[model samples]
Target: MIVARELPVHPQASFFGAGPYPARRAAIAAAAVLAGFVLTAIWSAPFVDSVIGDSVANGLLGYDAKATPIGGVLAGTLFAFVSGLAGSFTACNIAAFGAVAPLVGGQAGEKRRFATTLKPLGWIAAGMLTVSVVYGVIVALVGTRMPQFSTAQTTRLSPRSVQSMIAFGVVGLVFLLLGLIALGLLRGPGFLRRHPAAPLVLMGALIGGFLIGRPYPLFRIMFRSAAEQHNVLYGAAAFALQSVGNIVVMAVLFLILTHATGGRVQRWLAAKPARIATVTGAALLVGGTFTLLYWDVRVLGRLGIIWFPMISW
Candidate 1:
């Protein structure tokens, strides 16, 4: 007698599942981002800056931090680290939180708590440092200063304003497009959808790019110091530390969530594809809208081209 046996079949996972879930996610994400844009417009357009940008930097490093001469390599490293820690709260930098959900995985029956928790953070660091190191090297080799430091102004735009416009505008569009893809409204990169770590890497790359057009006083100071050192390695290290500092708080929060919940949060999210889409899509939408409206549209108001509410922090 011959017997035939059938092998087990497994279902493929969707980046963002099909069905009513996509529509629900899109609606929820759009509404949330819209509300955020409204609040930032009426309140703080460059929300992080208005909220804690220069003040945080100045308070932590002192007003003279920019002008003070570096005493040693260690001092400069410390400055870069502290400055990054200070900038963590900025609207621009805060967008890095979008990566948190993507980084955490809900592996079925996973028992290694320490590895599970720290692995995501390490992946994030790898992605972040990859971009930061490259950017630092390129910037160092080319030898340029932060445009934000320039006082020269055109009829309506300054160097700083233009930098903000270009940097945030590009990054915002990318985030917006990513959110759309995550919501299933658009196609995502094949790799990004298939690989677990791809989204985290992309998110980290965006965070590293923050150095391209940042205007924070302490950051500007750090950049100048890095330039003066004229060592590409130093620049790379400083920028690396900066990225590290930017996410320290968020990392702590993620750890707390994982430990406090005993890893239930990610497991719950992983059980359903739509749940991940909801969290990630919402974050990307908010980050994208805030970046665009704050840096570009808000600049128009500063130039007196339109009326945007002005507030004193």
Candidate 2:
């Protein structure tokens, strides 16, 4: 029988702190989640895509991708990819930045900057591709769409509101559980803890799944076009690229961090198991709480279930 060796402790500092203290870690996690909830209730934190998304759309595409005339196969595909890139920082997908914490840290005995940066990203891409392609293909086959495109209300809640809640709720739960496990508050499957790649893949899946509930104007345009086309290959390819575009910025940042430092910073931080836990835990908690609170609390407030400050005003 082989016994697993303990990770070596590194002496350093990071935004998440390199020290190991359960009490402090728990407090930080709680605070981060609380902030997520508050910001979400107020305005879904990062849903303000118009500012950035529109700017990108106009700057590059020469017109607002929102409800603009998208022509030609090439135009449709480019619009899909660009629109996705535009919303990369929206509340719908912002939480994905957390995966950077784990990816920044090199795997045990893996120190090459190139491998360290690309390997986990590859795994994440695989996960994202799986979800996005399947979703797109399903859209092609069923010709169905989210109720967000409609202006109808169902009693206390609009169908679009309910749809948003359901889609984001599921993904939020996944993030919550992952955060708990990372914080050691919950004991998940042994393999999840044993294999670092597992959580990263899961992260990517959740990020890709963001599209399922996205109500952004630009994305809605893309969705409408893709659905109408009824082309399986186009839908799959389009969604796959969209998913890639979603993470392109973060992935680039990760690459720069790893390559710039030649993996030294990553090594120093990832060297300590405790620091890795801290960063990963904080990220998951914030993302989970934000997704759930933004979609549910905000929507429910609009439905009169609960009072939200922003909604009241």
What C-alpha lDDT values do all the predictions have?
A: 0.68, 0.73
Report each candidate's C-alpha RMSD, comma-separated, in the order given.
Answer: 4.9, 4.9
lDDT of 2: 0.73
Per-residue lDDT of candidate 2, residues 134-188 (tens digit): 9988776666454655667777776766787898999888887777666667666
Candidate 1 pairs with clashing backbones: none
Regions of candidate 1 where Cα sits further than 4 Å from its true position: 1-23, 42-67, 104-112, 144-149, 267-273, 309-313
TM-score of 2: 0.85
Worst 10 residues of 1 by lDDT: 6-15
- Top candidate on TM-score is 2
lDDT of 1 by residue, 61-171 (tens): 665565677676788788888889878877567677765554443332244466656866776788789988887776566656546557788877889778878987888
For each candidate, how many residue pairs have backbone atoms clashing (under 3 Å)? Answer: 0, 1
